[model samples]
Structure formats: C-alpha cells, structure tokens
Target: MIDSDLPLLNLRDICKSYGSTPVLNGVSLALNGGQTLALTGESGSGKSTLLHLAAGLDQPSDGSVHLDGEDIGRLDDAGRAQIRRDRIGLIFQQFNLVPSLNVAANVALQAQMANRFDAAFTAEISDRLGLSDLGARYPEQLSGGQQQRVAIARALAPRPELILADEPTGNLDEETGDIVLTLLLELVAETGAALMMVTHSPRLAQRLSREVHLSRGQLAVQ
Candidate 1:
C-alpha cells in the first residue's frame, strides 16, 4: 500500500541496457518527501536515463524502482501512466506545452488531468512565475525563460508528491536559470514535494540538499 512513511522514490541496483549496450549499472538512490537531490554528470553519463527510470517512463533491466512503496517495475503501462499523471511532476528541457493551449490552460492542464485543479492556486502560480500577463499567449509567443516558467507552473500545479526534472534550466541565461531554480526550489519546499533534478551546473547543484554524480552508469555521492 502507498504510505506517507515510505520514501517517495527508491531505486536499488538498477541497470539498463539496449542490445547489450549498457546504460545504468547498480545505481541506487532514495529520495524522501521535502528533500531535493541534484543529479549531475557529463553527456552520455546516463543522467537522463536514470531520471526516466525513476519516473517510470522506462523500466530497469535489473533491480527495482519503488515509488511511494509501490514497485513501479511490476506495473503495466496503464498503471504506470496513471501513477505518473496523478503523483509525479516532470519538467524537461523541451518544455512540452500544447501549442493550441494558452499559457493559463497549459499551466492548469496537468492539474486538471490529476483532478486537483484549483483556480486560485493556478492563478497564484502564474503570478508568481511572472506569467500573469502572459496567460493568453501561446508557447511561441513567449521567450525561452517564459516558456520554461510556464512548464514549471504546469508541473507544480498538481501539488504532486515527487518532481523529476531533466536540465530544466539548461536553455536559459544564467540569470533566468537562477530565477527558475529559485522558484522551483521554493515552490517544492512550500508543497513539501521530493525533487530529483538532473543538472550539469555545479553551481546550481550546490543549492540542493544532496548531490550525486553519475559516471559510467554508476552513481557516487558528491
């Protein structure tokens, strides 16, 4: 049964491979509620792959992934998707927003799907993200930083228990990245959500509660 006492996400001896080309190996980690962990590594170091496994977007070839005490690896596609939609928030470098939806709709999309939408909360997040004036704008109408802010608002809208972010600030200027990171940290803290973010920026990683380095498909505490 899912329980609050359990770690939000736990990975044990995880491994992944594609046609004998191994990606992750024996990567073990656990994240608890209200904690922020930074995952850092070079390109091809398997940071994104590890994030995917944690999010249940893919299964590890060996070992287990537990989210809220449920073994995600044992779940069928539909079950995993349900957990992802309802409990986990994801932010990626691509900032996947529906072009047809305006900023307001985009921000509220996941929350609505999760059946946790709140008009006041959505408006509050948009205003906090500096998106209040841009609610009617589409993705293309916004700058990179603005678009990423929208993505952040969308992810946090549901007040999820866990947040998995992959280089969410990778494309922004240093100042904008700092702003986004600050807001993300602050919001997650306010919501008491566990966070595991993949970032290449050492400076940014320093802000997290913990940091781990991924290399050659393995993890080392930093």
Candidate 2:
C-alpha cells in the first residue's frame, strides 16, 4: 500500500555511472508537496544528473526513485512518459519552445498532450505570466524572458504536483533572473507544487526552502 502522505519525490541510495565511471554515489533525498529544494554543486558534481534521474530522463545504476509513492524506476519508457505528461512539470535554462507554435499554443502543448487541458486555467496562467498579448507571436519573436515565461506557463498549465527545473534563470541577466525566479517561486506556492531546482548560485539557493549540495557526487549535510 502506498502512503498518501509520502514525499512527492523520493530518492534512496541513488547511484549513476557511465560505463565504469561513477557519477553519483549513494545519494538520497526527499521532497514533499509544496516544498522547494535547491540542488547546488560545482560543475561535474552531478547536480544536473541527479535532476535528470528525478525527472526519469535518465536511470540510475543503483537505487530507487519514487514519484508520488510510485517507483519510477520500475516503469517502462511509455509509463515514464505518461508520468511526465500528467504529473511532472519541467523547466529548462534554454526555454524549450516550439518555434512554429504561437505563445498560446506553446503554453497549452503539454496540457493538450495529457488530455487534461483546462481552458480557464490556461487563460489564467497566460495572464499571470504576462503573455496575454503575445498569444499570436511565435517563439522567435519573443524576448528571452518572454520565452522563459512561456516555458513556465507550459509547465504550470498541467497543474503538476512536482516541478523539476534545471538552471531556469541561468541564461538571463541578473535583474531578469531575479524577476523570473521570484515569479517561479510565487507560482509554485500558488499551485502548491514541490520544486526541485538545479542552480549554481548560492544566493538563489537561499531563496528555496531547503538546499542540498552535491560534493563529489555525494549529498552534503542539509
């Protein structure tokens, strides 16, 4: 039986390797609903690798990853894909958007894919992200900040319980980054979703509820 109160995302004794080269070794962490956690580390410390494992984008060599109390490692690729489409939201530094789609279509893409599209919620999020007037514009016509906002709207449009973000504000200038980070946190709180963000800035890490540092592929003390 699964516990309803279990952490939304859980990792136990996770390890990853490339051939014989170990990346993460015996790493464990948990993230509960509505909580925010920051993953921080130097380059090659496996921060992004850990995030990838959490998102089911990659598998670990050893250990278990549970999302909403279900063992993600046990799922097939299609199952994992479904989980991503229905339960998890992802934000990336590169602002992955479809160049051919206008802002409205891009924001609604994930929700439509899951067959859980909510028109009211989509409209609300569009306004909240300040994308209401850009509905007809394609990705190439938007500023970097606007593109990232569209990504944010797309992620949240599904109302996912867990959001995994990889250096979401890394490409922005400090001022824009601050604004976007603040908006991300606010939206996460509003939706009561747990956020696990991979960031290189200690200053940004402090804004999250908890910070986990990876040192030599191992989690340092909280």
Where does candidate 2 have its weakest 10-residue lDDT segment? 1-10
Q: Per-residue lDDT of 1-222 in model 2, one digit per residue for the tens?
A: 224589889999999999999999999999988889999988999988898899898999999999978999999999999999998899977787999999999999999998879999999878876789999999999888889889988998888888899988876778867876786787679877889999989999999999998998999857
RMSD of 2: 2.1
lDDT of 2 at 122: 92
| lDDT, residue 4, candidate 1 | 71
Q: How well does candidate 1 match the true structure in TM-score terms? A: 0.94
For model 1, residues 150-198, the per-residue Cα lDDT tens digits are 9988998998889999998877788878877887788778878889999
Q: What is the model-wide C-alpha lDDT for candidate 1?
A: 0.89
Where model 1 places Cα greater than 4 Å from the true spot, the runs are: none
Residue pairs that clash (backbone atoms under 3 angstroms), model 2: none
lDDT of 2: 0.88
Instruction: Give the candidate number with the greatest TM-score.
Output: 1
